[model samples]
Target: MKKFTVLVLVVIMTLGVAGSAFAVETLDTNDMQQREERQSKASNRFEAMKEFNDEHDQIRVLRIERNHLQIERMEKAGVIYDLLIIAWDNNETEKLRAAREIRKENIEINREIRALHEQVRTARKEFKENVKAGDFATAQIHVDEVIKLLGEINRHNNIKVTNLDEIISVLQ
Candidate 1:
């Protein structure tokens, strides 16, 4: 009887151990599935964010190019204005042509600048919408892009202003 009781207790303990191990394995499998799902979601978000950033950068490049073109247009206008002034002072007949050309070019540049401003406005609106929708990762990317664009604009404007000042001084 003593031997039989001991055998029964040992079997019971082994079953208990096995049951607990099975439960733990089941829980671990479920946990692993949840973790994988989370990782997949995060990866998708990262990819989307990366794509948004790339597109934003491309737009910024185009904006910078447009700004450069605008600066060149302004410089050209300045030179032409100077020529017009000289022609007027010397009673030259080419003053009318220079004046008309400057006017036409200035009008075109103004239109281009207006269009670029509209593009920027649209971008900002979209950025705000993203932020409001809780896509902060994408919104933050847009903010960074804006900062970079602003920096470029500031640098360009500074140089243009200095050059304009020099030209004005020379003319005076």
Candidate 2:
């Protein structure tokens, strides 16, 4: 009976030691899991930040391209105006021919201008639609396009335009 009791006690002691060792390992495992969770969350945040940065860069590139196009349009407008002046300086008949050419060119330019205005109007309409849909990013993109078109129009005319009605009446 004495020997049996000592063997039982030894078994119990071994089991307790094993259990304590397992507990330590379990604690380490839990710590590792918590660290993994934190790392995953940080990775997700970094990915989101990268996506935002990429989108911002794309928008900046688009703005730069739009500005370059506006500058090109302004340069073309200046050339056309210079040609008109040169025609006038040559002679009256040449001036008349130049005026006719100017009128033709102006008509073409006016069409383009009106088309740009229509584009702006359409962009505004789209922006309103996007706003209603809660798509602020798309709305902002449309607004930027409208601003780009407006800049091009302003550079083409270089004149103060207060009232659309008066401008149309005068042009007519």
Instruction: Give per-model CA RMSD.
Output: 13.2, 15.4
- The sequence of per-residue lDDT tens digits that candidate 2 reaches over residues 1-172 is 9999999999999999999999999999999999998887676556544544654465466557657765755665565466555555764464455445445655666778788889978987996676555566786687778778876766544321222222233222
lDDT of 1 by residue, 1-172 (tens): 9999999999999999999999999999999999998887777667656756766676577667757756875785577578658766877655455445535554564465456456556767777777556577777666666655555554544444444444444444
Q: What local lDDT score does residue 16 receive in model 1, on the 0 to 100 scale?
A: 100
TM-score per model over all chains: 0.41, 0.39
Please report, in order, the local distance difference test score of every candidate based on alpha carbons.
0.65, 0.64
Runs with alpha carbons beyond 4 Å of true place in candidate 1: 1-48, 101-105, 108-116, 134-172
Where model 2 places Cα greater than 4 Å from the true spot, the runs are: 1-91, 159-172
When summed lDDT is taken over every stretch of 10 residues in candidate 2, the lowest stretch is 159-168
